[model samples]
Target: MTETVEPFTWHVAQDAIDDLHRRIDATRWPERETVDDWSQGVPLDALRDFVDHWRNHYDWRSTEAWINAQGLSTTTIDGVDIRFLHVRSAHENARPLLLTHGWPGSILEFRAAIPRLVDPEAHGGTAADAFHVVIPSLPGYGLSGKPTRHGWKVEKIAQAWGVLMARLGYAKWYAQGGDWGAAVTTQIGRQNVAGCAGIHLNMPIARPLPEDLAAPGPDELKALAALQHYQEWDAGYSKQQQTRPQTIGYSLVDSPVGLAGWIYEKMWAWTDNQGRAEDALSRDSMCDNLMLYWLTAAGASSARLYWESFASFAPAEITMPVGASVFPKEILPAPRKWAERHYTKLVHWGVLDKGGHFAAWEQPEVFVNELRKTFAAMD
Candidate 1:
């Protein structure tokens, strides 16, 4: 691990932006989907419209500016250069909080919630709820350096996080995440790493063990049915990413439309949108996330994490204080009873009325309040 942490800034070259537009303009699109709905994937009409806006009206520089407005830094940990945004609250005794983003998402997901978290008083809360926020671009995603070797699974990532917080001189900290982040945070809790105060997850991955399944109740059965539904209808992306990331990587890295459609489908399918994904998330926000994957060429490398650990990324029993905010439309909303089985010391649990897999992005105010309420008792 290198002790030096360097300040970082994002500046996409003009030529690169021009090239991206040219590619979008010249894309060889496929025929429209057979169905009227999003069953076959991102509808050709929707993707074409999105690409047109991306080519003509979307402003990448504004997104870049937004990211640069936050405090950015990079450090080498476990042989990879990790980029992160570290924002400290003005309030003394502010708690240290580390946030992790999942696949098909980036640190951009938390952009709206950062100010509220770091300076709660300014966002209609007390200094007592302030947090020193740190949001890292996951390895092989966004501005973070892609791993050259093959061993960058969730466990290694969790360990690297421990090292990261320590390097920042934090003696104790809370961790929070959704999706892959949830997996990493869960691992951190299970490891009981020194200085890790507790963990909170928006997507709690607590499944019924074989025994629990033998005589399950309605909630457990509902959770199981949801999991089954995911495996059946919603897991094709995971299957491909886990089995043939490089195959899909070729298209994702080579074609911006391919990358956009790939991610756009998830935004549509996974969000709490009634019919269209844009109902819950704006085109700019969706495009911002797509740009992270496109600019970094992280399509394959990021997907490789699934190949590396999907089967093995099962939830472990954790005794550390745990908090969960269950979004109703999450990929799989584990029942509180099921979560209690895995999170033995579950200190907080909130069943959100709305929101989905991308809770922070979909409902920033709600997400922030959940974090504040979840961790308040910890203090």
Candidate 2:
């Protein structure tokens, strides 16, 4: 049977938007955090200001228009309908590249990175640097269909991505991702199936060995410190989602304010923002991401991915060619030696000075350049 792909357009019901406003207006206020800084989480004032802008000023229609412009399409793979932005390059030599986003993010995370990757000539690069970008909404995230059954782990998603690329006639392709996206992409390389040429990750997963623990270097020590900080201060959401997604599902699914607050804390913590998440990402863009969650009621479905795979996040040895760009502000920065231990065929390793977990969203130019270089090394 021939593959079917219909163009998708975005138009949220007006009633839903009105209801969102009513919910925001009726939000039961929480007491302000005692700390002036973000030590206790997104400060009350910051969240109130963000919620106010979203309720009163953010243009959901404009965001919908932008999504429609990105060449949206939908097709069912396995048992799920995946929504994606497929931007083919004008250049004939463009390589196929699949980009994925993690929790608290949708395909909108790559809004800035897409045009640059697909049309590098206009941006900065030559035809050889162009990519036919395939950015799919992960199962249970964004506009993709939520899995009705269990077992949609990262590895399963990796296999489904192979099917997606093959369905689109991409026998050979490159994969890139951050956060959970990285985990899935790593699994792609681990499976090494259906002509995956290479994989690139902004947040590569690699654990330290006993020897390294006994005698840590500067980079490894710093990475460990960041890991400690994340476990101690930034991992409450992870713990909750990995253990009981259904428990928090009630609040996240029912209350838009709850969903927004949950994601806003991540944006504040993960981005390379100097003081505030809005400093690095535009309020409009942030609201656009938030709306992806709200419109789809994806808060619980997205979190379920954690429950599926968080326990199996152990490092696996991969023989396929791999490259990684380690942003300085990554939640857990990987030392070159650690990456080399797993990605034995590690070809490109870039320790960037700026950017963070949301590499493409936070720094598009650098992110695109890193893609061009990393995949080129894979070539």
lDDT score for residue 263 of model 1: 92
Q: lDDT per prediction?
A: 0.89, 0.89
lDDT, candidate 2, 1-379, per-residue tens: 2257779887788999999999888889889989889888888899999999999888989778888888788888777898898889998679999998988888988999988998998999988899999999999998899999999999999998998888788989999989999989989988996779999989888999899999999999999999999999999999999999989988998998899889999998998888999878999999999998888888889999999999667677888888889898899788988888898888888889898889999999999999999898877
lDDT (Cα, 0-100) at 179 in candidate 1: 92
Model 1 segments more than 4 A misplaced: 210-215
Off by over 4 Å in 2: 1-3
